[model samples]
Target: MAEGGKGSRSGSDSDDQSAVETNLTATVNKVDGLEVQLVLQVRGLKPKGGLRSFLSKFSNHDNPTDLCANAEFTKWDVTSSSLSIEICVHTEKERKKKKGKHDVNTVNTETFTYKISNFPSEIRPEKTTLEIKQPPGETSYSFIVLTLQRVDKSVSWENFRTPRNS
Candidate 1:
């Protein structure tokens, strides 16, 4: 009886350890025009809700925004122990049609796959800032800085400009 009790307690302790939440960190960069890539090394991950449970709820709902509020890193690849996501940055002119209003420069984003097997050699380095925000009413947020140096300087206007006719 004593041995069985000890075994059960050890199993319960292991289960408790596995349920602990872990914070994830990642490196992000923009490569090849408007593509943003993220490289994450994660040991374990847990969303606010279970991934499958959230997806099931999302599929039954008509509004797409609900899914965005529920899930994290929806587009990810888990191979062995690494995760990568390649997203696209979309910029649009948001014009408010009111009694009198000017055009607004608002940016929106979409996700796409960006593979970086052989990075270009003539690209310069640049830095990008990222801010992670929770839902509008929540007070949880994070700021991250990323270094992305991949610009081709050879294609600038100085290389192909002719002297203006004076």
Candidate 2:
């Protein structure tokens, strides 16, 4: 009975270690690809309430107005020291008037474009500020951001890189 317990414990420990190794190996493999810039532009519009309310309760507010863009480098093979991304904004106005309806309603449409690449600078430094605001009664929401993720190229490569950091 004592021998069986010891064997089971050893097997469990080995399994745990194997799982950890597999996860680490997978993460390293993901980073081996050439790094590319990812420009993620997020905009907030007035809440169109429905089943979406259950999922995004926070976005619903009376005065909703704010937009943000985030930049990151990933999804490639080259190891780059710098990254750059660009965000562009455009607006369109639509007039809605009915022949037998009450009045004309104007709709404002906003569009954003993201240009991502691996470089050393930003396309528009003034527009790239971390904080943005909308006028009047400003209702805003922000998100937790992630910068970078380490990728392992090879076990041999990691062995050398790990010692340099220490």
- Model 1 CA RMSD to the hidden true structure, in angstroms: 23.6
**What's the lDDT for candidate 2?**
0.24
Q: lDDT tens digits, residues 108-158, model 1?
A: 333223223233223332233222223344332222222334345333322
Q: lDDT per prediction?
A: 0.29, 0.24
Worst 10 residues of 2 by lDDT: 1-10
Q: Which candidate should be chosen as best, given TM-score against the real structure? A: 2
State how far residue 157 of model 2 sits from its true place (Å): 21
- After superposition, candidate 1 runs with Cα above 4 Å error: 1-55, 58-66, 69-75, 87-105, 108-136, 139-166
Cα distance off (Å), candidate 1, residue 29: 24
Clashing residue pairs in candidate 2, if any? Answer: 28-152, 33-76, 33-77, 34-76, 34-77, 34-78, 35-76
Tens-place lDDT per residue, model 2, 104-147, is 33322232222223323223322222223233453331221113
TM-score, prediction 1: 0.23
